[model samples]
Target: MMQLEQFYCRNYRIGPSESDFRSMYRPSAMLEHMQLAADGDLNAMGISTSEMLEQGLGWMLLATDLSILHPARLDEEVSLFTWSKGSKGVLWLRDFILTNHEGDRIAEARTSWALIDLQKRKPLRPSAMPVEVKAYPEHSLGDIPEKIILPEGRQTRETDRFTARYSSTDSNGHMNNARYADLCCDNLTPVELAAGIRRLQISYYREVHMFEQVIIERTDAADGIIWFRGMAADERGTVFEAKLQLNGAA
Candidate 1:
């Protein structure tokens, strides 16, 4: 087991803007914080984004499984630790742990990433990168699924349709991975949003570019889990899919 001390960690203070109506940190904001910590870990390992992009290559997220034990609130300070769990073929795995100022666990996540050729938009073999992989300790949240499967035959409906805008893009020039969480939540009813998300798992199938319209579909709630799927409106295929497990209002 990799120990916490072996990971690269960063501290963050929850600002008012990062919280929701209940003052709890928003799911999107938490995802962003995890991303920042991952970036920090990559930088520490001499695997900066600029360095990769210089080679006409970049990292793309394939999936993420996040479990929120206790969402942080405004004015609360938390520490986020992230480390690589090594690579397997073209895919690399990483894990994150977020702890409160009192050292209590708050959240944990496991993420899978793949290297891609920026020009061709094709995945590259892990060997294409010069960086070395090191296994780290896994968080207490347990192992995450390599893929999230949506239950079939559930009552489904078209929730919303919208076009991706420049503002929704990230440095990679595609829809930001964190924004997917926001989009998923947007499909939820007010009551569902108020229930809040206790756990979230997302799988990215294809990238969505600016000006591309997307159709959002969601399955009726089943045992507190709501499943969502986003597809390109033009028949470009599936963009991403997600499952959210809800918790009662805070």
Candidate 2:
């Protein structure tokens, strides 16, 4: 682990299994690495999951905005840096930067989280936490839109409903955040997938539990961005929404 002035950094060598058909790091794998970095940072701050649970609290992700400039290839070593960007009421913000071995940035992400009461599942104020908030250097992605808007006049199509499997569920008893990327991407057309995703933004609205069937809907905007929405098949409403900006095919 490498420590910057106020950021926690970790090196990850992209594994063969982590690559997609394009031989580049998959979105889900990148998200998993980001989660690890977040865990490491929280642990360094003496607020690990167990510690939070002991205080009757837990962290819940609200949204994440990731921009990929270049994808990491198999066996490539990437450095990931993360830091807390303070909090706004009940919402805590964190940001990450991923760089290649040459030190050129490949991806950047910003995430929002809420501290929740474990039993009640209600958000708690960040000030109530025992840890000291630190002043950290900022790495802004230049106003990442919190909401992804679908272009007017675009047609929406729905995919076959599928259930949340055991393999997709996390300890929280819901589909893992990273798994949502896979689910969303699975709904993309082969052409769109082949074009390669250059950016992704996901907002988690509700938790989808194991065995709950989900319906994925997508709309392709005129600007080449694909917007996706995952709704509960049982009519419980929208569970998650995502947007993918694709690079033109070679």
Candidate 3:
């Protein structure tokens, strides 16, 4: 049986600023909270990120599948619960739930990650991890597909191009993972942004370093469903791809 102590929990308050004048928490912000809870969980266990870095190991996110049940309002206190869902082959999985102060679930996510060797920049198998985490078997989003596939023969449009700024880079010296949602969403029609995001799935293919340029494109596949791909301006291939599902017709 899974014990309560095995999961990690943290609380946070929504800020005054919000997404698209809707006073709703943005996907990017939710992602930031997710990262915080994951790090805090490991940190409390005496395996902090810096410590892992010193050992030439670090966590890298490959994909995330999230669902926003209800929009988190501004200035509200919320609790985030996370757990290490264990590792399989080269992928380590984790799951999370965001709840209001009332204990009602508002959001949940499933993610796939890799523990990469800092020096070699390659993913290590679960058994090869220097540190061990007791993983539980609960899956909040059920099974996440091993891959995120964009629509075949999908139409694409070049929407915008920009360089990764200093503020956008994280400790890995690459564009912060959370920032990709904003990069893709920024290309959406204002109506779509205002409609609010109900679900989002993203896959990271490569890293974008500080000051490196990226080209973003958009393709709408179905009603309330939009896909985006960010490619390296220098032709390093796709940096990331995302699919956003809006709440309703907008």
Model 2 over residues 164-210: C-alpha lDDT tens digits?
A: 98998876667888988898777788887777888889998888888
lDDT of each: 0.84, 0.81, 0.84
Q: Write the per-residue lDDT of candidate 3 for residues 81-198, one digit (tens) a residue.
A: 8988777789888999888998888998999999998789999887766556866766445785346667798898999997999889988878888999889778878778777889
Question: Weakest 10 consecutive residues, lDDT, candidate 1?
Answer: 137-146
Which tens-of-lDDT digit does each residue in 163-244 have in candidate 1? 8898889888888888899898888888887887899999999988899988999998878888898889999888988888
Instruction: Give the local distance difference test score of model 2.
Output: 0.81
Model 3 steric clash pairs: none
Q: Which sections of candidate 2 miss by over 4 Å?
A: 1-6, 137-139, 149-153
* Candidate 3 TM-score to native: 0.93
For candidate 1, report its TM-score: 0.93
Cα error of candidate 3 at position 124, Å: 1.1
Q: Is candidate 1 or candidate 2 better by lDDT?
A: 1
